[model samples]
Target: MSPNLLLADESTGSKLRRNLLAVAGTLLLMTTYTVLVITQPTDLTGGLGQGVALATFAAYLLSALLLLAAVLRDLPVSTLTLIPVALGLNILLGQFVGSVMVPLYLDSIGTVLVGFLAGRRAGAATGVLGTLIWSLFAPTVLPFAAGAALIGFLAGTAARFGAVRRVYLAPIAGLVSGVLVGTISAPVAAFVFGGTSGVGTGAVVAAFRSMGDSLLSAVTKQALISDPGDKAIVFLIAAMLVYALPSRMYQSYEFVRRYRVLGNLSGERD
Candidate 1:
């Protein structure tokens, strides 16, 4: 093989290796936290699971760092620049909707957009980073960092499946994604926060709780109701925003080129 071909093969191999390690680390950490959260000791003040929770937090932070480092290795500088902008979009809209006590968490719009444009790693990184930043002010968001990363990962998966090719299909994908996300996040919400994550979501949970639903069941019911519509709206908005941008700008992304993420409007890569 030519030197160029050899180099390309080496680069691809390295990327694959990094991603696999990151995925494994993230999964391990996710499982650890999920298990701990679910089986939290009832006597925290007297220090039953406090040490374990602290250790888990450290492990979680380390895993996040590893994932971020691996995913960022191959991203172009231009794509990296968009992360902050996307994060801003996530925080502003999410915070506003949350502050107003809206049941929908439209926080992942930017995460979904990044995932659709840059592929899964970048998308996951964006979600993770945005969640960490949000946690600075909203401590409650800290535990859901994995959920945000999942949203970004799913957005990229949806784009890979051509969900973005048709405007309507994007929202449909989002709705389906919501079901999976909601189910995964329900355990955390129920056990950790006692089903009181957001004002609107809490109200729904309360309604279910009042109806004699178990804690987990009430939270899961509320998540099923809120997450699907929230994600659908987010997907539709991201799709519109993508199409609204100048084709030249979006077409330049390597992901858009490789995946034909923009469909016929993808244009030719320079």
Candidate 2:
């Protein structure tokens, strides 16, 4: 059990209640937004296009901030400090990779890294917040915040299950995560954006469409083709980064210590 969870004081109960509320609220908001986009794409993009986008941005930001607040209480100050760097890394690499010739999007490396070191809540917060920040330059990404959050959540879950213990396991976990993410995000891309988000992914979708696939079908097929590879690469990179960290540094995280996330690397020197 986590030492933090062992606290029995009234304050701990209060904190727990508030944390649950925050997490629930974040999930509600993100889920509501995703549903709204999937069900009423025209409503969101019709007369109130920019306004709706701004509203979504605000809602997503609030969800992310609430999740971050809950995570802040659980994670150490040192671990919390890495979030901005991670967010920046997501945006920089996401944009750079999206614009390149590669079909993969390597945006969540930092989020996955945090998940490997911290836990799911922190990683999910990082993913949603990073996507929100990235949306500042690209408004189209606003609708996909839920998907981003899922990546981080999955990454943390993967780490908690010892996916990072072996280098090969990371990509395998990512491959599975990619299929799930792709299915979840396909509806949004198809309904809201006509099944194309980037040039490479768009090309894949177009190829699938040319083969007589419906809009959603083409997008799903494209996502399955691209997302698994993208996430596999992302997870492999994240696992490599975690392995590169000095044992002492990563060991400082309570999540790592409690879960033995690194799988008995005590003999390794800092």
Quick one: best TM-score, which candidate? 1
Candidate 1 lDDT, tens digit per residue, 48-161? 545654555555556666777778767777779989999999988878888998657798989999998988888889978997898888887676676777788899888877
Count clashing pairs, candidate 2: 0
Model 1 CA deviation exceeding 4 Å by range: 1-17, 29-65, 95-103, 267-270
| lDDT for each residue of candidate 2 in 51-138, tens digit (9 for 90 to 100) | 5555555565456566656655665566679888888888778778878856567988889888888888888878877877887888
Model 1 weakest 10-residue run by lDDT: 40-49
Alpha-carbon lDDT, every model: 0.79, 0.77
The per-residue C-alpha lDDT of model 2 at residue 189 equals: 76
All candidates' TM-scores? 0.81, 0.77
Give candidate 1's TM-score. 0.81
Lowest summed-lDDT stretch of 10 residues in model 2?
A: 36-45
Give the clashing pairs for model 1.
none
Clashing pairs in 2: none
